[model samples]
Target: MLDAGLLVPTAATGLYQRSGDFEDAVRAVEAWAGSLRLDAYPRRSLPPILPRADFLQTDYLRSFPDLAGIVSVFTGGDAEHRALLEDLDAGGNGSTVLEPAETVLSSAVCHSVYPTLDPAIPDEGLRLEASGFAFRHEPSLDPVRMQSFRMLEHVCVGTPAQAEAHRDVWLPRMAEGLGSLGLDVRIEAANDPFFGRVGRMLAANQQQASLKHELVVDIHDEKPTAIGSTNYHEDHFSVLFDLTTPDGNLAHSGCAAFGLERIALALLSRHGLEPGHWPTEVRRELG
Candidate 1:
């Protein structure tokens, strides 16, 4: 029988603990990441928790203000704590103080990679492999819409043609990679959730320019979830970080990111509770 508690929803909405077959599905996702051998010289590094100033430079705040996760620490000393305790003891609600920290939790896996580069790309280009936890504020009851999740991304930086070509090649491969695991996948043009009224224009331009594409699969309802995305950022990061090609032209960049938890949820939702009974190819690939 399928355990009802496979994914334990936490008190915080959109957060979940993976257990039972859910964990097994995530293991399968790890194997999928390992199977990709496209990098000629992949720059592997630990994920970064970025300084607030660094994150501020990105258009993240402008585009995703509602979803950004700020890191803060309690600024209260013992005296303040005692005052709150006394207030609570006297039947009043306790109050706490929190101050913004120097850093914010990572919102995207590739956000920090560009700043760490050598400032100039080689003639061939650059490829990077990064994996880490990321935070967002899309609170929901759906297990697939996790507020916190693990992500694996392959980033490419070079000329415009090079960056576009890399996404072209990988988009199909990513769909195949997930489909092999028995998940139904589709690739479609999409746009970022740029904030506010002006954001509508930005999103329209983004789609018109064909800057982003997403691989989606049905998880919870008829509305499909975007499990992966391929983005062609034309000089967006290059201008921000002053990145350049060997010949001094502005560099373009692209990335393919896999949402590990969403992939796991899709697998369990489609294949049922038993990982052992998953497709033979998927079991062998995961093993």
Candidate 2:
């Protein structure tokens, strides 16, 4: 259960009345940030919603057009009423429209990250861990299926080896960090939320290439939910952001993100809401 705010509540919402596990998730992100050893992070603040056009270049819109937002502009009452009639008629006719209005709404936290993956990140590479509120206008109201949520991400810009090594190194670190709290975990292949024709082709190629992965955790006492993902965007962001390497070649990129509320659900579903009442060891670890 969730409030209208869609946050795990201390009173009426999901299992836990306290958010220790949620706090631990934050701790996990902070600890991961400490491990990066980078000097400065290019701080970013997301606009209410970026132009759908900017997102198109990232191919996020093309890949997952279903995730795109539909907009209709009206000149006056007649135009508005006509547009409404047309929409109703279209729906009744059961016809699909390959619509291209604005770009697409950002469905994730790092939507602004790529544009900042500067071409000149110097020799060592760029590393930053960020956390923020993210919105996606998908139709999900299950406490687990939230329309808005928090996302924490680590953006990496470097060579392919560095990019791969980045995830290979941190994936286990994150898993180990969570495991210390008694969670079971695994690293598995993943697929994207690609759109129609063009997106289908790109997603197929990405899947075959094994470019994306998720750190699936058995959050519940039963089956698991993907609490986190480690994705390699093999020069996709580099091209879009104009990110470059030592010789000024397009740099490869990757990101690891954590879905905050899902982890809370995991804790409650697995350990129960009265986690503080659990055994000393579990309580201590999460604390």
Candidate 3:
């Protein structure tokens, strides 16, 4: 992709400036995914940064602290600023002068959605289609493992049955959608990269309960990459966000998230770098 000018690299690993062609491919993939169910769900557009208070509520720090990207800024006075500059000039890390900002880079697009929902959901439940940028602290040379990426997600909040059904329905649908794009796709049980030993137990329980499933495609010769995922949070967000069903039970949440850049890369890898030259059916589907 770098050789083809589809991706422009920066000094930061896992971060790249996408080309027009790359963005076009991303939009095409997003459009294709949206066409699958956009009309049924209300749409939401959220910022990439989340309120620190809400971030704390999500408990991401407990589960994936290693991947969290906290936004820190210089909130110092003039004297402090001068000292910070002098420190930097003296080869000292200026970050030492920075303080945590009110917001943190969102780890997932869906994290911001939960806070927006009502404390009590209706019987039919709530469903939304949201698209936004997401961030993680992991830095890697692998293009597929981008530290910053765009996500398009369909989120459902309701009873456990509703959440499970939402995940179940979308998992295969996403796999088929990607397969239609001429890429070999598979649906498999997966778990989040939780932190530490306790997290290992959480991950094991998550897998045991089949709470997460991923739509994976081969973008590399070595292994398959997950371009999309379906996750069921059984009252996890509800307990934190204080959400409940109309009947008073805690609400369950499920989401299917599509990694736009990863899907675009998969398409480029499978059907050649040129989108125009991709199979006619694939082009038509993307359009």
Go through the candidates in order and give the clash count of each. 0, 4, 0
Can you list the residue pairs that collide in candidate 2? 52-103, 52-104, 63-194, 63-195
Point out where model 1 deviates above 4 Å.
1-3, 43-48, 75-97
Q: Candidate 3: lDDT over CA atoms?
A: 0.91
Query: Estimated TM-score per prediction?
Result: 0.89, 0.72, 0.97
CA shift at 186, candidate 3, in angstroms?
0.9
Compose the digit string of candidate 1's lDDT tens values, residues 1-287.
Answer: 22477788677888887785677677568557755748555646445477788788887999989989887765788987787778878887553445688888788978877877888899998888777778889998777778888888889899888899989988998998888878889999999988899999999999999999999998754769999999899999999888899888999999988898888777767776677787788777666
**CA lDDT of every candidate:** 0.82, 0.64, 0.91
> Across residues 210-255, which tens digit of lDDT does each residue of candidate 3 receive?
9999998878655789999999999989999998998889999999
Model 1 worst lDDT run, 10 consecutive residues: 39-48
Ranked by TM-score from best down, the candidates are 3, 1, 2
- C-alpha displacement of 62 in model 1, angstroms? 0.9
For model 3, the stretches where C-alpha displacement exceeds 4 angstroms are: none
Per-residue lDDT over 1-287 for candidate 2, one digit per residue giving the tens place of the 0 to 100 score: 23422245443232233245455544544444344433566544454355566676776656665655544343346665666668777774312322444533457767666664556866877877666655555554356655556667777788888888877876777677656655677887878867777777877888789887776776445566787787887887787877888886888878877776666566555665545555566556555
lDDT of 1 at 13: 88
- Candidate 3 to truth, TM: 0.97
For candidate 2, give the lDDT.
Answer: 0.64
